[model samples]
Target chain A: MSPILTIIVILVGLYGLATSKNIIKSVFCVTIIESGLILLFLNLGNLEGGSIPILSGLVENIVDPIPQALMITTIVIGSTITALALMLCIKIFHHFGSIEWKEVLGREE
Target chain B: MNDFLAQIPIFLVFIPVVFSIIIYLFKAKWTTYLSFVSQVLLLIAFFAYLSFWRLHPGDHLLVFGGWSERIGISFFHDGLSLTFSFLAIFIFSVILMYLFKFRRKDHKFFFFFLFLEGIFLGMIQTNDLFNMFVFLELTTVLVTVLISYQKSGPSFQAGIYYLLLNTVGALFFLIGIVFLYNVFGTINIRVLQELIGTQGDRTVVKFAYVIMMSGISVKAALFPLFTWLPKAHGVAQSGISALLSGLVVKGALYVLIRMERFLFVEAGFHMNELFFWIGVVTAIVGVTFAISQKDMKQILAYHTVSQVGIMMMGISQIGLTPFYGGVLHIINHALFKSLLFLGAGILIKHYQTKKVYEIKGALKTFPIVAVMLIIAMLSISGAPLFNGFVSKSMIKYAVKGNFIKEALFFLINLGTVTSFIKFSSVLFGPKAILVKEKNPLQIISIIVLGLSCLGIGLFYQVIASSIFGITISTNLWEISHFLDYGLFLVIGFLFYRFVVKKDYLPFQKIRHFKLTFESANYMFVVYLLVVLGVVFL
Candidate 1:
């Protein structure tokens, strides 16, 4: 709900990132932290009881439109980033024949 | 007619994107002739375009879809953006020239490289935050592909890690954007800044600034989130490594600089302090590891981390300070670091060895390559009259008021010099056997770079004056900077020599956290849907 809460989530993400040995898990924790920040941001845009920003005569309380535009672009960007991450995951999995960082790094010939 | 030449800024961004599509469609099957022909033409055209900018003095150029400024999508061209973009184009062209030497098995490499080039070209000019995100994404996707082009396991893993965290970062940037838009009801950056300045006490704007900046900072590869950089840049092919290190990371910094003047002028939020420390930490940590590195590529990778830290140090000066020194360092770093990476590429290719200790006596194998590497090393080490000294001196000058920052900055430069000195010993020693010189393409590319390093040294004042829009009143051959540089170089060498121990500490593994809650794609979708629900309901 608060920006500080968002920062706390980021710290949690960093915690997971630093401690986890499984590559995919670390990535997902980072995702969680990122998502929390995103939620925190959306909450800040709340117009103190503003409704969805639409103009069908069904709602007079419309929120901002720019965030939605940005969100659309962000979503597009996020999907591609996910795809690239998965590709890397597969590469890591295949090459060192293990999913753990220690094993792959240890096996570097 | 002058307008056609003035179209330099736009066409520099345009030609690559248009030709990339053409190459994708028709030149897809035919790689050699078209790739060769197009890159040369691209280089020539790009140079002529930059020269045109030189002629137009202080004329801020803008092109906006043939519409008025507010309604149109604007490309803001100024001294800062133009020079950076020009550096990107120049180095990218060199990559293009050397690209054929490997004759990479996949045309996909060309496809991605060209696309990456196009993204870099467009990103440096756009003034819009939204447009910047789009180009940034383009860079992200293309770079991941390039890094994983070989489908090597280590590289692929590195790519995935990079993507995951960076996606997370970008998402935060987007959320910040949305919040700013929701508050201000506009997406134009200039307008957004003006509104923020007027609002004066919008806690939400400050929140947005912090959130968005952290996201970009992740891309910039600053500390606490820079873990992804060394591995990703390390595993990438030489050309890809060069581009990633030299260009893409700077994209995020560009946004940081643009936003800082207005959005991030807050107290106790000094990126300068954070960045100065980050620069020093990375420089020390990076070189410490560089000394232990057996893999030449990995060593180079660590050096990238060092340079990124230095770049960060330069940019951190933007906080409550009037130092444009950071901008100059960015230019200096881009040129010399790109040269260093390119030099590493030649070493890797020629000797068929990536281990530092294994590739002994490079001077015997390839004299020209050896000479270029030495020049690049000296340039990076802040050796007298080199480009590094000019900016390093400027940063020192800029920090005249901040003693703590100045001391840390000095130490970081010393660290840089120390690492390069270590790098030099391994470079030109002696040849195992005289390795055959490869094709002239990589050689010619290195020659061009070497010439630039030398030219910069010879004309430091001219470059200093040209970029800053101020002529130097002092003598060009002044001994002050050289003396400082020499003192640091000696100090750095002594410090590293005395401090580093020979006991090899085995490489430790970086722990990765699992995502039990949701997948990256799933989280991304949910976030977007929420925004959509909030927007169009």
Candidate 2:
């Protein structure tokens, strides 16, 4: 099922996050994990033969719209977090002159 | 009057936010005064609501747009939530006053700062899970920006680490929500609380509980997920550090208490033993690290972690007395810890150093500040006649007959006393530095906090009975309690003199130990797995 695939995607992202040396790579790994979660949420709300959530006409098996709306909010939040992280990355690189986590974060004050 | 009471929750959240935006857009000189005026008005409104609620005590739920509670967003005002909201607004007002002199012209700082207060208020009052998620994420973003406001290298690094780790944690929380929504078809906590007793599946509920708790653990700065706390709290501006340490972390804890009330406890999940042990470990780790730190801010930061552990231990106990003890400690810790951070900020600013060893004779140099700091220190160390002693004794009294728990409490108390003995070294010795005149606002804020610490300790019986509705049977001012406190002071002084003063090798190792970014993330995942294992087994 796609849920299992989504779990694997999340695991993959965690593994990458655990092993990534570059800060930007870590940021992307977090994005990957978030995307996986988004997929999982959408998949959980999906029905076997569901139509779009619009209820103008007779919509008996419309997929749950709550998860879709929640996911949209999550996507917006996740992207803003990503943008903030990247902005901090730019600042980190400027100050430490390197984007590698080991290089920038490892130094003592 | 009833209509006004209903609108108080919304106004608490929006007043600061609207003011912040107006301040930003107008950039006028008088806007600062307006903001101050609004804060005073909000305080008055909070008191009015509190008095009204006291007159007619019950849960007050306001559903937005007049929709039903199940579908619409709801703000629930109970004693617990209102107490925390009052604390948040109170502390924010103090911090605003503390920063008024220097930061009045800095509109950018006010924008994020006031906006953060609104989000924090919203977080505490909301009863919807998804709305909590949104507030938590917004809090994270606002805190990140505030942490790195200095634009320094360390600040930037700390800010990013906090953002990434907390965002990942929030994502896990979202995943938990997905599972819950799929099963229950509702995200309202009250509705779920009602439905969970009859219709919830055990395994999925347990899984979701573990995942969601892990996310909250990070926010609450539990044992494994606390690496960012010291860094961020230590590196930010002093007022921001006070706000973060005093109120921000407590917001997460309030959520934890709420979740346990509605879900775990209702579901018959007895996580007390597990959380109790976690609390012990967190306390031990925090105290050990705090003793080794030279920076005053870092010591106070780690102490927040340790105090949080004590609160956790109190909260995790089965009885009502212990539970309320923990709740009282949350308020008590907010008061004293903010006082400590704000006082340390003054010392650091005047001395031009964060190193506690380098700065000497605070009592001689800044007499008023030093005196207030000592009051805070005494309160934190559980000295007799201080607020900390009252709550700590309440928790201690709850575990009276259990030998292991009793000893653990003693050991934690001893460690707290020991580290504070080491911290108090700055108060004595000879005056070596000449500092400038004191800021009246700063002094007033700390003095108010310090006096409250004493006043609460002295009047704990009335406060506990009237506000919390709990009558204490254990005599707080008994001779035995004083004797026990004296023993801790003596033993702690000896330990600090012999071991910590000599810079013991183990302490040195703890001082230098730092978790890298990747490893901290790895530890968070490992923490999640450990919680999953424990909950399942």
Candidate 3:
């Protein structure tokens, strides 16, 4: 919920993305970074003590709905890319018989 | 008629989408014909809209869903967006004409091609930042599909690398957008530009700019983030390679220009120096790699990197003249580079090989294509009386009286000439064994592009004025300009014969030096950190 926590999540994602050898882990790391970004956007729009965006008679402090709408689009885009990436990894695996980043290029002529 | 013409931007974007769906669902063999008809219609719409813009000379906004500006998507047209979209349509139509008769029959090719056209049309038209991001993602996915359409060879690997890196880059872009939105509540570009101007320079805003620029640099294939480009452009289908090198990367550069010239114009000078150095480094490294490459496609691929650097260098200068030069070069580079790539494709297909050494005597076997190749080669190398000369000279004239910068620019030109000499070697030597008959449509495509090169050069003033709405004197008739080009050519020829020809040890080492995907990913992190430091420190 805190902005600092989201930054840490992003840093962790970057670390995994940088160090990981497996192609699948790279995709996972991308998803993690996307999640962190979505979380940050959601946090930015939060009212300290707010009700749902849906208008009710009791609605007093409502959260900004723009970022939430933006995150939904971001989530869809991120997931599509992730899905395509994993599919490509499978194709790479089929070609190289290994999905480790170094192994694929090493085994190729 | 006037009222109907007002919605031309909508027609340009949606027609392709509708046609692509039609092509896909029908599975008809005449899908290419369908695509070509739709593109022609779009081109007509563009011409009508462009004439309207010329008469009005202002932004024409098209609001979607009838919502307010702060909440809804909008498409606006001015000169720049119109020119870019026109370029996309022009190039795509040319490609469609060539591919219709020459390429192998595949239904999906038409689908992807049309889809990409529509996406590019939308990319230039949209004014919303989030909408730009969405189109960018769609383009990334579509380009990846087109690149890996062959589904084998190095392209598969190239596709994966391109996909992964670009996805990461897009995420960084999204992060930048998030920061921007938190600071300023709307995602509209014009609104952001006004806010940035009013608020002065904030550290968070500067940081956001750096983050976004880094992300875009990856897409533009600038310096450190360009590892995936050569692989994808060199190994993919020739049409795909030509499209990627020629127009797709320019999308990112367009965003870069908009941001620098509009959003962050106040602090632009601080960032300009950084851009200048990066452009110089990218240019030098690109040409160095190009000089060592034995494969024709790889050589062209590397040259794209160098040429992009040159464009960046042009824009980094503070003057409007140099910036105009940079914009013109984007158009020139797309025309000549795609012409070269497509011409090379014909040769590669005929010979059934990509190695330059394996093929010989192009001038003898394919006289027309070889002539086209020569025109393209000269234009790219900035020979006098070519399209490249006009823009390159403008850039040079912009940085006049600065000796070190002038010399650096000269060195880049020298490198360009030297590498192109090596590339053009296949045109000479004895006649090679002919493999098969060449396609008539391929020759037509080459000639059309070749004529455009000459036409641009001959009508440089008129073309520049019309497209960019700027006028300047071009003294190509002067003797000194001739001598400069002549001297550069002589030096370049000698360099190629003596140094590049010998397979020198350093060249060999650099040629064999591979940047793996993991290391390239590491470089992205380093690039981001360095950019952050440069912006905030």
Candidate 4:
């Protein structure tokens, strides 16, 4: 059920990405999709009644730690990509004087 | 010595990275010299290790922290990975020499460039799926930085488009990994391969394969996803363009080959027929677009797409000969295509124009560049006694009996010949104003590549047998082969004279055709859906 929900969220992001006119919006949409993916991965690693991954007294049904570890790395990587994309966006705006995809990319060299 | 040989993979990946950081921190005047020395030393070490490994013949896997292979991140040194790593280092060294001769003083560019090499080497050698994902993402970032290094508007545009599109594609790959990890509880490819062979839901595996391949198709620039390649490769500096076109895309193809071998083929899935048809379409579409382009780099960029299609065709064949033929073509294409791009770079710089029609009399103004370009052209167009002829004939020999496939091959080759005929016009016209050749380093790099093309063509049998251990049965020197090539040249000349030279309405329309970012994403989605439908239904 959670997987389906996260997938729907991902699709929403995809839809926004396909229709977004502004470059910033596209970047946000990608972030949305990435957030959804992270959620989906975490949910996949969850147990029915899992406790926090920290090993307390009983250690019953500790959620799988690998997905959490992987997602942390993914988050770092994804943020770096987001920062890079936005930086490129700034550069694009500085050069073309508009951040609209049509206005920026459509100009003839 | 044996231990050192085993650790070559680690060194191959980290050496560039370590050098890049040191160069970045130091920012000394001798950074270029230092980088050059490092590359040369790395090449020497690689050759020494290669010889030693060949003599000793032992497993070269490096599991980190002394952990079991299934649990730890690992690097596998096999024939395929080692070959590609060698290519990465070799091409990076050539570009280094080219830059050193050009006297580029930017420490930042060197930093990113060397870092990119490290990431690329890591991508090629990694055996873990998650590890590969990390390397791939890092590569995309590095390539984006390199593409936008010029800081021009078009460069930024191309960089952003490439970054966003490829990130989305990488996300798809990640999702595929999520599904696999969910099912198998492991992300190690070797472990997954074994487990998948024994048991797994067939539908899930099929879906995973489709998703993973869709992501790879973007990287490989197959069919609809190739829109970014020309924009990116066309806008960059010549060395970057050559590296991007020559080796970077091949990394994706290498991954595809690995995935197909370990996962799809291992688990009772055979999509060779599907890939063959896709290859045919990619070839036809790529050629149609290439033939209409007037810009020299754009024309060469589109040909990379078409040649990749041809490579896919050879790889998708069932026979072993065609498979290695495709592999060999990858190396051959790298040689000639880099030579062509580097040559085009020189011409573009000296002639001060990118349009083929506007730039004339290269033969007179720059004799060396012209000669090198001719060799590259011959190699690309499958002229006899050139490298392109050898692999192309191998692919042709595989499809010899089937009339329709044969016709498709013939059509693709004809397209290549015709477009090159159009390209060759720049070599001949009235001699333009004489421009003195200033940089001998540029000449040296291109000459090295050009002679390599010739040498590879001349000694293909020895190289093929020694490197790949595959004996070629196709008689390369057959009279019929030369006759066929001559026939192609003649017909291609006629076609170019009558149709392409005139620049018909259809050609103009094709030249003007452009895909917006939104539409490109839509096409990616449509491509994914289509592949999914084809695979499942």
Candidate number of the best lDDT: 2
Q: B293-396, model 3: which lDDT tens digit per residue?
A: 88899999999999999999888778878888998899889889999999898889888889988878889988888999999999999987899988887777
Candidate 3 is scored at a TM of 0.97
Per-model CA lDDT versus the true structure: 0.66, 0.88, 0.85, 0.87
- Candidates by lDDT, descending order: 2, 4, 3, 1
Q: How far is candidate 2 from the true structure (C-alpha RMSD, Å)?
A: 1.5
Better of 1 and 4 by TM-score: 4
Lowest summed lDDT over 10 consecutive residues: which window, candidate 2 chain B? B51-60
Arrange candidates, best TM-score first. 2, 4, 3, 1
Candidate 1 off by > 4 Å: A1-21, A26-65, A100-109, B1-10, B27-30, B36-72, B262-274, B318-322, B399-407, B434-437, B479-537
Single-chain TM-score of chain A, each candidate: 0.77, 0.93, 0.90, 0.90
Candidate 4 lDDT tens digits, B323-404:
8889889999998999989989888888888999998888887888899999999999998899999888777766788999
- Return the TM-score for each candidate structure: 0.82, 0.97, 0.97, 0.97
Q: Chain B alone: TM-score in each candidate?
A: 0.85, 0.98, 0.97, 0.98
True contacts kept of each: 0.51, 0.85, 0.64, 0.65
> Candidate 1, residues B141-199: lDDT per residue as tens digits?
78777777767766776677667667666766766676676566666666665667666
lDDT tens readout by residue for model 2, B185-299: 9999989898877786789888889889888888999998899999999999898999999999999899889887665567777888888788888988998899899888999
Docking class of 4: medium
lDDT of residue B43 for candidate 4 = 88
